[model samples]
Target chain A: MSEERIWTAALVVIGDEILSGRTQDRNVAQIALWLNLQGIRLAEVRVVADRTEAIVEAVNALRARNDYLFTTGGIGPTHDDITVDAIAEALGVPVIVHPHARAVLTEYYATRGGLTEARLRMARVPDGAALIENKLSGAPGIRHGNIFIMAGVPHIAAMMLDALSGTLEGGKPLASRTMGCWVAESEVADMLGAAERAFEGVQIGSYPFFRDGRTGANFVIRSTDQTLIDACFAQLAAQLAAAGHDVVDGGI
Target chain B: MSEERIWTAALVVIGDEILSGRTQDRNVAQIALWLNLQGIRLAEVRVVADRTEAIVEAVNALRARNDYLFTTGGIGPTHDDITVDAIAEALGVPVIVHPHARAVLTEYYATRGGLTEARLRMARVPDGAALIENKLSGAPGIRHGNIFIMAGVPHIAAMMLDALSGTLEGGKPLASRTMGCWVAESEVADMLGAAERAFEGVQIGSYPFFRDGRTGANFVIRSTDQTLIDACFAQLAAQLAAAGHDVVDGGI
Candidate 1:
């Protein structure tokens, strides 16, 4: 609820494989992380199957509720991939092959000899929607209205995100400072309480993790201001040292 | 969509930790996996913050959409745990401490001699809701209007899920058969296509995994019919073996 920072987004992960628990979807977590750093809160995330009705419902709901809606999956060259038609249906638009998108797909397939009908399936998009650049595969993801449709594959999604980075209008960049020590989360309960009371704008989270057979907790202080973040981290370090816990600087 | 399937469930994960990308929620995946096997399709999965408004919105939406709703998180003895009150708001009911829930909490605290005013916060429940037994700790989860509210902790949620397992009205029990081989996903694409054609009521998914630095793929055939699933797996194995890929015995 900060001024000049009213951006909110939603993620719609479309795939029957994910709902069936056969495939673990990774794009939601990655996209949520990326958006949060830009102070763009991801308000909702829905994972639905490849069914047309389910996809249309999710797309329309998210597009109406969020400032930006991003969808991953169902953009591949398979018969089950029906995101284009579903998205078009949601927007009440016609599904047609965009010339630019077709060009990109043709160029991509031309390298291997020629484009087949199956390969051209990736070129279809909702009419009037602009193409999102895909540096990895060249067959671009399409963006219409508030919805940004990207590939289901993680590597391809990452590449699409990078290509479309500059087009996105970001909010105030959120910052965080991490301080870890050889202490449990419960041990730092009092100091955490104090830190929470001291910082109203920041969200302080304690993560107790066991890694390499060692138990430790990371007290992460997140805020928009770098100075405020640094000040909180210093106080957290001092509190940990006072509590007889080994304090160490945890990198971002 | 099958006939004679009377009930469905949805999961609403209430916590800022998940949205902040600080904690990876395991409950959604666990619930989906268990529910799928029991033939109860998880229609939607939502992750919201500890905020009462967000929780209420999601709880109401999911409750209206699915036959049953399950909520995890915000039941602990902390200020951020506000799921009880939020559920009441969603149902337009007043939240009060139930007699049985209070008795369990009082007895639990009496044993440890650590009962504080803040610790009793877990006893708050919406009116007309029944308590779901929590075997891990005496503090019980609440169920109201087909919404099952449980702890966010993975083990506690699992235990609560088990206790509520008997109460679930199921559909056709979903079965899966996995065939693991050395063939890459692309190499077995044709076999998968054929398997899908051969199995009408089943959903075949391809999972490419890497274990011990060896790349492999797992083709999982899922269906309500056990006979069709077995037959499909047999056909899949035979096709893989015929194509020079070693087929292993992998039953459901």
Candidate 2:
């Protein structure tokens, strides 16, 4: 497992609405799942307000640490939409009106209304950036190096991810198996620790929940290697069974 | 507004389930909303894995910049739960079995199961830490020098918050007013910017949504001063109306 290549990405969610609790962030989960499907692990997530300095700080810090950096929100056609400007500043590049983006917005708004000055704001991108196609809206996503600037809207971000599917280089996706038992996690803490330590690359997570006046826990075993994951699960399940606990196959 | 003190808090969400996309975080919004009600601003949020180094790093970094730091998750009774240890290490203190916490857990688990050694893990706390009562769960939250360590479960965290409500010092709660208009956010971008600038201490946020086969945007004016927020909302709403746009009072 130490010899295997592992690719990681970080996400920065930028919006005052989210920080104010006015909006619930769906982008983190959406992006994490998408990155997982692309065989990349989502390592960390930061939620910052609609501030230029904050955006720049998060972008620079994360991009330097991870293989890829993704940002969501503040990519709209409003004064608050300053993500492009901040990212451009972070990269030491100038903001430019991407021609393809302008063309797309012009055509899309031709039927609704002529592309007004405010609407044209959507075309702005960091210099020397490639466009990620957006099937839901006219504003295309910006891609420069390993940094991807995406829309704040959940569906729009999903579309951008769809455009990016299978386009990035990554290692094998993580595989996981969940087993549930109606026992306190603490009861099996020793077994869980020993199994995890025995497996080379496996990491086990225990989630406890109280339902219908009963306490239960779900143990999830994850690893890049499917065989290792399976072996770890088998060992854990056997140990739990030996301790008089019934293992639910697919989790409760 | 500039003369008024601004109380800010940051949150560190600790879990592997969240980073794995297996869990959607509810703590950020819940804590943000609760902080707002307490006249404190939620400045930033970071979601990190269940690693001691990551927890320590996030805790040290955010605790220095903000007035208060709240951490959720990684406090359960399992091997994966190591928040107390990590925080204790970060604070350069040894983990001690808090007498109050031990008594509470002992009594709570007396009927279900005797407080075993593994269950007693929940009683460990950083030295010199005070307990924040958890009404839902017997294991209380940890409070040490402006750092509040809460449960991962949303309801239990809410209970902990309820116990500590109004106990912390804070400035005036921010006031906000929302207005909805049946127009693209880009169409009113300039007007929104101007209205925000015209009113002192007011910041406006524009959120666009597509509904009923039409695009609309909601403008929210926020400020510590209610009068200023109202003024900003009135000016922005009038401007939208003057432009032949329908304005909804309470937002779309």
Candidate 3:
């Protein structure tokens, strides 16, 4: 086994909105992309409802297994926003209004309106938590131990991710290259498998798309080493071209 | 507790593309919506990797708790298509090539390409499983016990869902009404909470959006009873209107 370690993070999407299909979630992709740049792997993601028990269970399970755990949504100023309370329960801690978070909310809401009691709910966090800068909004994110609570909104989550970039301890960042071809993946599955086997440590993912009455797939080669990815991608592209399939460089 | 039972389903999204941030997932929302129409609540969704162990863990954990479990991805004819194998292991059953599935694939591939060994991989399913119709492509979905193994592609999954529509046993379908307003959700948090509290067995979700440099929100009232949703919607609309926030009947 390789001695090199890979840091992994799991995300808990705390919302009834996403579960009910009323809203399409964008946070998963955003967090996944950002985690990759920081040399962290997004290993798992759970979309759980706003229920307290559900949140507590998911948070506890994911945080115990992953190096880091993140939760998006249920941190807003609403009655359904019970992420902090649930997380606190999961961690066996009490919920408290962080002094810094309170001050930030007070200042942000000063010009708009004095922080009402309902709005003040945003200041709550798990006990002994630090604040992650919410460059997009006044309500800062909470980071308790290995768990980071972020906003449900994609842009706000982006800001929180930006604030913590490069701060976490991680191994080599994963690198990937996409090679698309206008042919059915099943037709070339054997060659693709062979290439992947030959390029030890590289993983190739085939994503098929049906567009304009044409069926095609994009094969993604990923590895922690860029050189390995490049070599694998080149071999796959050449194989597809040799098979008389038109190869498209970045995906179709 | 309400006497009416809420049939629940858990989805295990088996894919490396999604976890790698290479593909944006459309399965969760699509399955959630379809399940709602079938009167089954999509209680939770786990996006797991393509690894056999990960798939086995998630499938077993979720299947034991939920009324039905659905999985998407890794049913293709590639080396990474390990969902069927993992699921079979989780069920403690041997994998076998289903006769019906093999016959279907044999006919479908007759015109396209002779059922090559690579293509024959799609016919393999867990023992004692039935096939779900896949209208889009040659391969069919697999079903064993209460678990439904579906295609990762959104449209193909949709076709399988269509074939199984109105076939599952469920109670009343969940109904919802979206009321939008051009005001920060924080501004009306108290009233929204009050409205939700006023209605029994109804839940309200507040979604805030920042669009075109303006802040706004949508309050969604959901319940199994259409009448309950309507009444809650009306009460909330009146409250928001009285508070001087222009309420859009449908979400902005």
Better of 2 and 3 by lDDT: 2
- Docking category of candidate 2: high
Writing each residue's lDDT as its tens digit, candidate 1 over A175-204 gives: 777887775454456577678789777767
lDDT of 3 by residue, B9-85 (tens): 99999988898887889999999999999889999999999889999999999999999999999999988899999
Question: Of the native A-B interface contacts, what share survives in model 3?
Answer: 0.74
> Candidates' TM-scores?
0.82, 0.97, 0.97
Model 3, runs deviating above 4 Å: A1-3, B1-3
Alpha carbon lDDT of each predicted model: 0.77, 0.92, 0.91
Interface RMSD of 2: 0.9
Tens digit of lDDT per residue, candidate 2, span A129-199? 99999977788999999999999989889999999999998889998999999998877888888999999
- Model 2 over residues B114-188: C-alpha lDDT tens digits? 898888999999999999998776889999998999999888899999999999998899888899888988877
Worst 10 residues of 2 chain B by lDDT: B230-239
Task: Report the backbone clash tally of model 3.
Answer: 0
